[model samples]
Target: MSILVISPHMDDETLGAGGTILKYTDAGEKVYWLNISNTKEEYGYSEELCRKREKRYYEVIRRLHITDAVDFKLQPAHLEKYDTGEIINKIGNIVDRIKPEIIITTSPGDVHSDHKTVFSWAKAFSKSFRNPWLKKFLLMEIVSETDFALPMGSFIPNYFVDISDFLEDKIEALKIYEGEMGEHPFPRSVKNIKALAVNRGTIAGTKYAEAFMLLRCIEK
Candidate 1:
């Protein structure tokens, strides 16, 4: 089956479901990525820095063995500035073209505004009646964003994918997002990434795993 992962930012797909993605690709499934936001100058990022980040984005995708990727090129962290309908239409257009059987996107409860916005858009565009080609919709959890959400909005994953074999590949892919990682105790740190995997794996009865909230699924 074909799969599509919608990310609010460059590194979120890696942070949230990199291992599962690796597993899918390894199995010869076509996996695509849709990055909805991009670095912008107004965000205190220089043109050179933005270019650097873009370069790494491609490298990360290559390392993950993704079949294809599309960047919406929207300004990062400023998704709220655009009209909701516009965002939905843009995402809908991509979904129409891709016709994926499964879609993985940001959780609605994520603390980041960009993530929240993208989740809403994904939900609207992937509605069962609206997109019959979509059989499953999975919500992934970003390390810092999902973990920091308010108690009432916490990410409670119900679906777990054992990623024991691909855990190291996930970490290696995350390393491509050089600017996002930090020392231990930081959510994006390599240590914490491994810790999260181990924690999820314990819950999943595996050596390592990735957890996702099943938003919707239709059995044929």
Candidate 2:
């Protein structure tokens, strides 16, 4: 079955679900990527810088062998006005068009306003589905914020897809976002990926991994 992955920024998918994507691809599932916020934001970037981030995003996808995709309309970061009407309609159209069995999105536990908006919009869109028979819905994590935030006593992971083979692919995909990594929030390099995965693995009892907040599982 085909799967749809929605990302707020360009590299987010890789930063979050690169391993998961690789696992699915290896299992012979087609992946459709929807990147919704490749925009020029003067508030946090110069025009050139914004373009660089967008280009880096493109590089990451290509490196992952994700050739068929759509980088849609520019949704503003943080203050992105959720056009529930438009987004709901558009997402329904996509669902109708692609008919994915699964949807993967950026997690809501994220502090990034743009990431949060992306998930919320995705939820609104998923509502319009003509087929609630959709098999799976999951929110993937980027930046490892959720792992840190979940208390040591009460953390719960609903699904675990081992990424041992594709770990390097995840790193290669992440290297595309050079500008943001060295600046703020994160170092944005392949190095941190190992550390992040290691930490997540420590919690989940694996060597390295990517975690997803599993949302829904429809009966097949």
Candidate 3:
């Protein structure tokens, strides 16, 4: 199976779908990562920070065993500044090239503007009639962003994947993003990630799990 994960930033994937991704790759499936936004050095971010972020990105991908990845390098926190149609067309081109069986992406209801923009373009490009090869469309939950969304756009997951065996691997991969994780109260902390996983697991009757909103699925 071919799985494509669309992330708004470098660490979003690891925070959201890391364990499930590890499970798929462990089963010999092809997993591709498409990151839509980045912290560009020219965006007033220090060169040192950009370099550090890039290095952490490589380390995370290496640990996840994902060999196929693409970074669009668009400026972070300003994805909406780009033309929606242009972004959708660019993403569509990648979809046409990969022809993935499943696509997991950031949620439209996420609190972060970048996440919402990524979801918008990703959803536009993955319409069933436009891409029959894409059998499943799922929206992953990112801590610190998805949880903080307004009640009207709150994430209500209808799908769950047990990541009990791979939970540790997921946490380890996320650890590479040293700048992202923080203390116990921080939403992106490792403790809370595990807590959320366990909570989702309880709903799915597993020891640890990742939750997603199943936007669509087609069985052949």
Candidate 4:
């Protein structure tokens, strides 16, 4: 099977589904790692910092032996102009090219601006295209460091996948976002991910699992 994972930023795919990607790869399936934004930003970097961090992100990915990784090289914040239709078309192009059996992406209530935008665009692209290979669209949470990530007022989970077997890999992947995280004080960061895994595992009949809000499924 072929799969496409849409990440808002470089580390998102890993933070959200690195273990699942590992699972798929172990099962001998092709997986595409696509990030919608560029790694550089003039505002956040002092020329050298950007260069250094960019190099490290790739180094980490390569070190992890990730097979397919695409930055898309889009502007840092996704749109200089902020046109939703343009976002849709761009994502549709990727979907058309990948024609994946499974599509994984960020969630709508994620609170992160880029995360929300990616969710909107992925939903639009999925509906706009009629790819028969597209059977499942899964939403994985990233940077669930806020109250919005919890079982909030309206957010509900549709399913969860056990990642206990790959929790160590998830921590390693989150480390790839080195510059941004920079020694987070909140133990809840990785702690929450693991905790969620255990909690979800109980519900899903596994030792540890990741939660997802499934958007589309063609059949059971």
Candidate 5:
């Protein structure tokens, strides 16, 4: 089965569903990453940082053993600036081409506008009538964005994946995004990541795990 992970930004994938992604790839399942936005200099990011981040992104793909990846090249944190129909069409094209049975994306409750926009696009293509190939649709929690989101939406997870064996792999992939992680107290810190995993694992009866909200599921 093919799986498509929609990331609003580069590191969101790692921070949100890295371990679960590793598990799928390790099991010989095809996983594709849909990178929704770009890190551009005009977005107040330095050109040097952009180049460095791009290099890291490729390294991440290598580490994750993803089947392939597609980049939307849209402006970061400014997805709202684009025409909604245009952006959705771009993502829809990818969905049609990939025809993935499973789709994972950032929670709609994320505080970041870009993440919220990406969630909308993901939801649009996830309807059962729109994509009969789709069997599962999940919303992953990006530490910083999900935790900091307003109470308009809650992320009470009913799905959990035991990522005990792949926890270290997730950490290693996250290490590549040095600029994204920070010391203790930062939501994306290595410590916090592990803490969340352990907590979820306890709930899942494992040593470490990743939690997700199973938004949609079809037995077929």
Candidate 6:
């Protein structure tokens, strides 16, 4: 079955479900990545920095063995500026082309506006009958974004995937996104990533795991 992962930014897919991605690719399942947001000059990012980040994204795809990927090139953090219908249509077009059996995207509760916007559009398009190829929809949690949204919203994961052997691969893949990693207390830090994986794995009785909030599943 084909799997599509929609990411709001360059590293979200890796931070959210890198290990699970590895498991799928290793199992010979086709996996595609769609990144919706792009860095903007107004965001104070230099062109060099943007180029570096783009390079990191390519590195991530290479690490994951992903052959199909697209960047929607939507302005970062300014997704709210675009009409919702337009955004949904853009995603719907991609859905029609990919025809994935499973779609994973950012969580609605994520603190980042870009992530939330992408999640809303993805959820809407995936549920529409016009796109019947989508059978499963899941919401993945980003470390800093999802965790910081508490008190306003919470991420309560109901689905867990064991990544016992792929946990290290996830961490390594995330590290490819230069300048994203932080120290121990930082949510995006390698230490915290491993910690969260271990915590989720403990709950699921595995050595390592990734957690997701299952949105929909149609059984054949």
Q: Which candidate achieves the best TM-score against the true structure?
A: 3
Q: lDDT score of model 1?
A: 0.90
Ranking of all candidate structures by their TM-score, best first: 3, 5, 1, 6, 4, 2
RMSD of 2: 3.5
lDDT of 2 by residue, 1-220 (tens): 8889988877788877899888887777788898887666645667887777667766776677663678774655643665667776787778778888888887666767777677777875444255664788888867644444444422256776678788987876666766556533454556677777787777778888777767787774
- TM-scores of all candidate predictions against the true structure: 0.96, 0.82, 0.97, 0.83, 0.96, 0.94
lDDT score for residue 193 of model 3 = 94
Candidate 2 structure lDDT: 0.72
Residue range 17-133, candidate 1, lDDT tens digits: 999999999999999999988877877789999899889888988999999999988888788899988777777787888889999999878888888888888887567788888
Flag the better candidate by TM-score, 3 or 6. 3
lDDT of 5 at 92: 88
CA displacement after TM-score superposition, residue 82 of candidate 5 (Å): 0.8
* lDDT per residue (tens digit) for residues 1-220 in model 3: 8999999999999999999999999999999999988878788889999899889878888999995898999998888899988888888888889899999999988999999888888887567789989789999999999999999899999999999999999999988988678989999888899999999999999999999999999998
Estimate, for each residue in 153-218, the C-alpha lDDT of model 5 and write its tens digit. 778888999999999999999999887889999888989999999999999999999999998999
Q: List the residue pairs that clash in candidate 4.
A: 161-209, 161-210, 162-209, 163-209
Clashing residue pairs in all predictions, respectively, total 0, 2, 0, 4, 0, 0
TM-score of 4: 0.83
Model 5 quality (TM-score)? 0.96
Query: Cα deviation in Å at residue 201, candidate 2?
Result: 3.3
In order, candidate lDDTs are 0.90, 0.72, 0.91, 0.71, 0.91, 0.87
Off by over 4 Å in 5: 42-44
Q: Quote model 2's TM-score.
A: 0.82
